[model samples]
Structures are given as structure tokens and as C-alpha cells.
Target: MTVITGPLAKQERDDTGALLQSTLVDLLDLSLLAKQAHWNVYGPRFRAVHLQLDEVVTTARDYADQVAERAAALGVSPDGRAGTVAENSGLPAFVSGWVDDGKVVEAIVQVFSTLITRMRARIDEAGRSDAVTQDLFLSLAAALEKQSWMFQAENRA
Candidate 1:
């Protein structure tokens, strides 16, 4: 039962909602993974990597809100519950306990790599269904790509 309605048609709203929902799950998981790394990162580059992880957390959270709000605007219920994110997110899981700075960077790079690829596909798909959602995906892709590049730089030998 949706109380809100936007300009999108039913099919457009449905497709956009699905795209945003997937993006929401990934973004929520990304924030959690980054926070976990932020708490346990160690080694020579600990300070830098730890701070960078915080940046990722902030980015993911900010975008998650945007995506969720976009869904709500379209009369679609947004689900960011723990179970939903855990089951639906496409992001790679982070190892538990303390992690080396190098490993953290490697893992984050991998996450962003996978997320960016998926975001590109969503962007393309949304382009056909809803340009507004496609624009959001494009913005998200830029930010994720930038973060990925920064992490990749740290991982370089």
C-alpha cells in the first residue's frame, strides 16, 4: 500500500523502484563494510586507510538516503532492513576482526569494483525506464568510481 505518488507511470515506478532498491541494499552494505574496516584497520597505512574508510561510510550513507527517498517519492516502499540488505546486497563481505591496511584497501577496491560495474548496468537500465533515476545512478557511479580509484592507488605496489 503506497501513499505517495510521483510523475512516473506504474511500470516506470516499478522499474525505478527495483533499481533504487538494489542500489539501496548495496549502499547500506557498503557503509557497514566500511565502518567495520574503519574500526579494525591496522598496519603502516592505518591512519590513512582508516580515514578513507570513514569517507566511504559517509558517501554510502548519504547516497543510501537519496536512493531511499527517491523510491519513496515514486510511491515505492524502500526496505533497508538488516535482513534485506544482507540477503540482497551484491557487495563482497569483509573479513571479521582486525585487518591489515593493505588487505582493507584490497577488499574495499574489490567492493567498489563490483559495485561500480553493477551501478553502470543499473544506470543503463534506468536510462530506459526513468531518466531521473538514471541521473542518480550516474552521480552514484561517479562517486564510487572516484573512491575505487583512491583505493586502487593505495593498493598499487
Candidate 2:
């Protein structure tokens, strides 16, 4: 990898890289969760929820890419294999292609809730380590929270 010099300190870059690697697992796990739900969700509101799930799945994939790039920027390879995700993801694996919508929603809520907590912790770490990473995580936390609200809204509807 080419050298990077910015306002970021060397130690901060290292820490941000570690944080991004850990977040790589979260993003991938979350991506699968959204995809699984997208493919399997069914109910009275099936069509609408299914479409929303598709949007979530797509966005999750993008988020995964961003985090992986962050890891690569730090000179460490990002883990992309399913096996690595199985071993490293802090969130539960969502593998079934056929599941009840309620169950799917509940499971996804559980996953993103973990994401909120994890992102907050990472934000704290980055706040101390790298302002750039911290800025990114701050925006990420807001987006994830907004996504969580979307999931929460389903129950109210």
C-alpha cells in the first residue's frame, strides 16, 4: 500500500484500521441479515417490507465496501470470506432463506441494535485515536440509527 500522510497520526491510523477491520465483520454480517430478510420475509405487508429490505441490503453492501476500503488503507486486508464472517462477526449469523417476517424483523433488529452499540464504541475509540475516523463513525452512527428507526417503524405500522 502507498503511504498516507494527513492530520492523522500513525498510531491513530493503526487504531482506525483495527476499528475498520472489526467493523468489516459488522457490515458483512449486517449485509447478510438484510439480504436474508429481503429474500424471505412474508406477511400481510410482504411487498412493502420486502422492497424496503432490498434497499437495506443494497445499502449494507455499500457500507461493507466502505469499511473494507478503510481497512485496506491501513495496510491490512479486510476479511471477506463467509468463513471469516462466521468466525469473527459479533452479530448472529442470519442464514435461513425462509423465515417468518416477524421473526426476520426481530432478528434483524437484534443485529442492528448490536451494530448501534458497536459503532458507538468504535466512535469512542476513534474519537481518541483519529478525528477523521471519528467523524466517519459519527455519521455512520446516525445512519445506522436511522435504519434502526425504519425497522422500528415496521412494528408501529
Candidate 3:
């Protein structure tokens, strides 16, 4: 952790930064997954799913930026390098090559669900250390939940 003169205590900053960094890694991975789905999805709903996946990718990138910036503010070096994200991200590996619209929706829904769950836990963890960080996680979690709902809606029978 880098030296920080923030209001949070050293340990609090360290702990909170750790949680944010982890979230950043997952968000980065999820963004890539979204793009993979966007590029590969095909079927009756191909146009709709393809466009929606772009939105998901944009949101993931935005969220990742927020998490990384927050971690940096807390004095931690956010590890967002491709290698770091590849190794540390908690998200499942995305399928390569072409995929059907239904399969793409399924994969994206699963990814969003996993990320939402993890973000909720990080919100709690941040609450224990810093309310500011907790609020950040809360906002991220809300967005992820919405994305998850949207993706799930597409997959319903």
C-alpha cells in the first residue's frame, strides 16, 4: 500500500483498498467477457443482445475505473494490468469463438450475478473500515444488480 494521508486509519485504508482492488480486477474481467459476448452473439435476437452487451461492457469499464480510482485514493496501487486481472479476477473465464444469443445471455447473467454477490460482500467489508468506501461499493452493487436483472430478463422463458 502506498502512503496515504486520508481520514481513514492506516489499517482501515489498507483493508478497504484491498477490497476495492479485488473488485477492480473482477470488473476488468467482466468487461472483457461482455465484449466477447457482444462480438460473438448471433440468433433471432442477435441485434438486441449485441447492443445490450455493449452497454454491459461500458458499465463494467466505468465501474472498474471507479474502483481503481478509489483504491488509489486510499493509497493502494490498483492492479489493473491484464496479467493481474487475468490471475486475480474472481469471474469465470468467458467462452471464446461464436456463441448463440441464448448462451451469451446465460453467460453474461452468470457473470453479473457473480459480480453483484461479490460487490455486496465488499460493501460490507468497506463498511467496517470506511463509510465512504462502503458507499462506493453500494453504488457499484446497485448498478451490477440492475445489469444482472436486465441480462436475466433476456434469458427467461
Candidate 4:
């Protein structure tokens, strides 16, 4: 909780920043998991799943940046180091090996689902302290839900 001389009170900013930091950690972990899937996914839809995984990685990275930037704007130092993300992120650990396209989709969907659930909780948490931070979480949650839909579709017949 650094000095934040903004419209929001110091306590409000600190609370919002904490919520954003949690989201950032999850986003960072999710980005890495997406890249892992992109590198090792194989099967009949290899090319398609591989490219889609890259899109997921890009989205996660973008969201992570947004959340981190918001925290910094409030004078809070964002902890986005790989070790911090690894240890603090709530996302489940991804299996490390070449996975079939369907399995990769399943894994991605599961991750996205978990992220969306957490984001929804963060949205409510932020709303109690800052509307702007709540809006940010809302936007991120929408994008994550869309990504989840795409991943789930790939698992369909």
C-alpha cells in the first residue's frame, strides 16, 4: 500500500490494488499455461488449436498488463515476477508434456473457467472500493468468458 493521492481514499486504493494484484497473478499463470499448450498441442486439429492457444496467451498477457498498470496508477507496486505468479496464482498447475488437441482444449477451458469465476468475485470486491477497478474486472471477465467459449467449442464434436 503505497501513497496514492487520487480520487479514491488510501484504504480504498489499497483494497482495489490487492484485488487487481490477485487477478494479475492468475493472468500471468494463465498466459504461461496457454503458451505451454501452444507449444505442445498435437493431433488432427494441431494447427488450429496451436494458433488459438496463441490468441489465449495474447489475451491473458494483455489483461495482466491492464491490471498491473491499474495497480501502479494507484501507486501500488505490482508483483508480477514469474516466481510471484507461480506461488500466488490460484490457477491449477498445467501438465508438462505434449497433449492431444482435445486435451489441450479441455485444459484451457478449465483454466478459463477458473479465471472467470475468480474475476467475478474480484469484480464484486472492487465494486465495494472502486467503480473503476470493478469495471476493469468486468471487462476482463467478459473477454475471458468469450475465450472459454472458444476453447469449449473446440472440444465439441
Q: Write the per-residue lDDT of candidate 1 for residues 24-92, one digit (tens) a residue.
A: 999999999999999999999999999999999999999999999999988999999999999999999
Q: Which candidate is the best by TM-score?
A: 1
Candidate 4 displacement at residue 74 in angstroms: 0.8
Show where candidate 1 strays beyond 4 Å. none
**Cα lDDT of model 4 by residue, 27-137, tens digit:** 999999999989999999999999998998899999899999898887788999988987899997889999989888888888988888999989989989999889999
TM-score of each: 0.98, 0.86, 0.95, 0.95
lDDT digits (tens) for residues 18-102 of candidate 3: 8988998998998898998888889999998999988888988998898888887877778899999888999978888999899
Model 1 poorest 10 in a row by lDDT: 148-157
True lDDT of residue 66, candidate 4: 93
Task: Report, for every candidate in turn, its global Cα lDDT versus the true structure.
Answer: 0.95, 0.77, 0.86, 0.89
Q: Please report the candidate that would top lDDT against the real structure.
A: 1
Which ranges of candidate 4 are over 4 A from the true structure? 1-4
